[model samples]
Target: MAEKGDFKHEHMADEANDNDTVDFSNNISARIKNPLAGIRQDVLLRDVEEFAAMYDLSDITPLLKKGALVAQNPADFENVEGLDDTERDVLRDEVVHKWRQPRALYTTVILCSVGAAVQGWDQTGSNGANLSFPVAFGIGDTDPTSPNYTRDLWLVGLINAAPYIASAFIGCWLSDPLNNYFGRRGTIFFSAIFCLLSVIGSACTQNWWELFICRLLLGIGMGSKASTVPIYAAENVPALIRGGLVMSWQMWTAFGIFLGTCANLAVYNTGAISWRLQLGSAFIPAVPLVIGIYFCPESPRWLMKKGRYSQAYKSLLRLRNHPIQAARDLYYVHAQLLIEHKIIGQTNYAQRILELFTIPRVRRATLASFTVMIAQQMCGINIIAFYSSSVFQQAGATVLHSLLASFGFGLVNFVFAFPAVWTIDTFGRRALLLFTFPNMAWTLLAAGLCFLIPKDSSAHLACVALFIYMFAAFYSPGEGPVPFTYSAEVFPLSHREVGMAWAVATCLFWASVLSITWPRMVAAMTPTGAFGFYCALNLIAFTMIFFWVPETKQRTLEELDYVFAVPTGKHMKYHMTKSAPFFFKRYIAMNKNATLEPLYRFDNVQSDAVRSASVTAYNQEHRKSETTKKLNL
Candidate 1:
């Protein structure tokens, strides 16, 4: 009714108002939006009432209301009415002192740690047995002149690769169903049984094929347990300390490797039965895992997914310090789940697996998960983890000295992993990967080049061991802790089990390839060539990570949905254009005043309608600018 330009300007101003509500521009600092942020008080109360009624929680409805309010705005817990001093103090501790968690939570972490140790022990068991078993089975091929050398090398590699073959092809794939039916604790217990029986069977096998079969059986346990334990730990811990707590999987796994080396050294002199004991001693870690898993509470998110809200509330009680904290987490997670269900929709197991590639949000997480998991293998840690003894022997050490050096490598691996507990959440996951990969690459190359030194020279073995130890030192704090922790936390809960299975399978598959080919590779390429090959791979892994992996420190599992929702192209462009230049200016050019703008805006308390309107307004403003420029031209 007004002049045409005036009407147009009025419409644009409305759109601009909408844009202001949900600024999706690159200038905004990224944050995880609170799921319950913008709901009306009455609406939230009604939802809580319905939730309590459905879950038989009306007995605690008043508590539930208080919990819901706190969950909606955790920062204002001090202002939450009806909260006592003790409850307020506990909430304060969660922020001011995050490490002061319930003892039950630590106990659960310990159990998962034992499960990880079993995995590490299984690997080194085969490692130590490698020196003796091939000869015992009539396939020793150390000499190049032997007519059966090639065949024996291939066979030895196959035996060494047996568990990973089974893991990659069979075990990892079974996690979803096992988790769906048996629950986390039950799945771990089942895997522990398999690990225990297989280690004992491996020790008793009379021939190569028998031992191979036992190790293959062991893979089933390794794959499933590896897939489940990190997820178990991630789900149980608070988001603030999730990385440090979950990384205990890698930390204790290193401990297990050290313990396995000790066992290998202890039984080195046992007449004719040394390899047998080395293989069987791995069962020790499995025993505790089999028994202790039941003592840990099942994951509350998983329980919530199954619609066992009452049970989830109970489980949360064990993990958190106070009843209010448990209720708040349970309610918040439930609210997030409601949004997740609306976004992801219901799908069958196969559909969920397909969604790993099909859904845009989920597929980003899949790519990121794959990047980190495969990077773990590409960084070449397992080559040393699986064959340090053989590598040391090749460096001209006597058998005992080789074993001792492998023990030293194990010690360095375990000792250096401690720093990641503090750094992973602070320096962050992506930063750790970027920093360590280059260091690992150079150190690994140096270790391999040391092989060129004259074997008669005393410095040859020392030089190789020194570089290898340095590589482990770099590896332990970064790639060692990040892969499992990142993979476990990245996916939405709807697809968590299958997503973790996919990630673990990718890791074990490549691990199998490395194990099966290294003996042949080392024989053909020499130590220098093989190490150099993986050294180049470390650089390639670093590049892939720089572009593909997103930083995911201190983000809750539910909140990660928004993080991954950023398209891969946008994420890649931001790093390539923005992050890369910032790094160059700040570090290379030594710029004192360089400031890198954040790529994503945080809409923590914004409603969907507000965000949508904000986008509309931003687009309208962009169009108006373009029109103005066109007119001027």
Candidate 2:
């Protein structure tokens, strides 16, 4: 089994011509179009001996001459200097090409999405509950002029936020152990069962305390499912589809919220008991999740981690279209496992947590994930998701009108979710974050500004609602889904489940802090003030994304390990543009030995529409290649 870069038979004379490296610019798009798509591992790993001697110029020039590899970017050169350029290229490209998409892959992603939907539905129902349940329980008055007008700020805040303590902390903490023992599917299965009981209990609550207990239980399931599903989808799908599929978890969560909003609208005027039915409908989605999850294929990476090699192979075969493709994927899974096993050794939870911070690449990944999760919750979208009905009511809508507006919020969330899945792989995760966060900040500020206009004016309220809708439009593509998809690809299988739990726990922390204290935030500062705070948070998120996050659109999970591991330098960020002289000047300053050519594959022209348009070209090329080899020739 020679490494795939072995050009012993195919290109020896070409390799011997040191200056004959062909122009790769034309094919760079082909490579960029599917950086993480799989090619055969056997084709990638055939030149073991030559690649092993990569430090010797004699060993390196051959592969470079063969046009099978290129030099690392100026930033990456220091770290990867020992490896020949061609070996790295094949290593990345093959991993992408080796995977053949399978039908079961989609089935598994959809099943996991049920858990996401369950979480969304639960959140939206509670948002609606805040509309009518406060009055029903005799805790607060919707009308300030009523006889029973006291807000009961303590009880109201407790009722609203008690769920977070359970869901964010306890539920998220529980996910790591559950995911470790039962795997992602089993964990989501148990979460669905718990949610079934919790949803019923919530609807039947007689007091604020009873409702709080029920919601706390609901949080347990919501938190677990939220933490587990994205990574499960990431592991099962090929990279070409990974962003779209993993993002669908968020989309389905939006779907669940849509169902919840529609339920609320149905029951808004049906008397005191209508809230109960609104809450109870959440149980229905859980029923399918509990039953369907067990039938879907488990993550092959997880199977391999547990030493069930045969089962891992079977699972991969079901997920991939070709046998050799399945085997090749397993080889990388095994290779990464072996590499980590020897270096990482045996570790306890404490050690793993410590390593999560200490390991340079993994730590950067964790920080990036944790930062995005925190930013996402704090970006002010949740304010709308959890309380749009109230925001509408406060803005001048009647109770029914507010409920209808909330339904629109959910509808927008659900409708825009489709675009994220369609474009996430091409648009690139970092680009979306960079582009959308500023727009979200401005839209929220505009909505807040609209509040300062004269009271009882329908025009002012309409402006505020319009701003909220626009805010949601910006949020759906980037902040809504990219965080989960980005978090899923950063960790190796060894730490993936627990690593994801940690990222989700960051959500728990922010969601808890934000959800628990939202009322106080609005009361202490005016609503306008609160919105201003979130606007600042979005700007902070934009700053972090600009400097820290790398483009991870088309790269494989393993290939991303290399992307994040690139040497960190403060000066490296500004020169990332397309100017060749700027990059060459910087390259010379750092390393004179490496060649002076532009190192990165993508350019500024990679807009969402442009990136998405190229996928058809790749597919057409692939179809043409297959036809060329067939008897139709």
Candidate number with greatest lDDT: 1
| Tens digit of per-residue lDDT, candidate 1, span 224-294 | 99899999999999987899999999998999999989998999999688999999999898887887887
Best by TM-score: 1
TM-score, each model?
A: 0.91, 0.77
Residue 544, model 1, lDDT: 97
Candidate 1: pairs in clash: 15-617, 18-613, 18-614, 19-614
In terms of lDDT, model 1 sits at 0.85
Q: For every model in order, what is the number of clashing pairs?
A: 4, 19
After superposition, the stretches of candidate 2 with alpha carbons farther than 4 Å from their true spots are: 1-100, 141-151, 567-633
Among all windows of ten consecutive residues in candidate 1, which has the lowest summed lDDT? Answer: 1-10
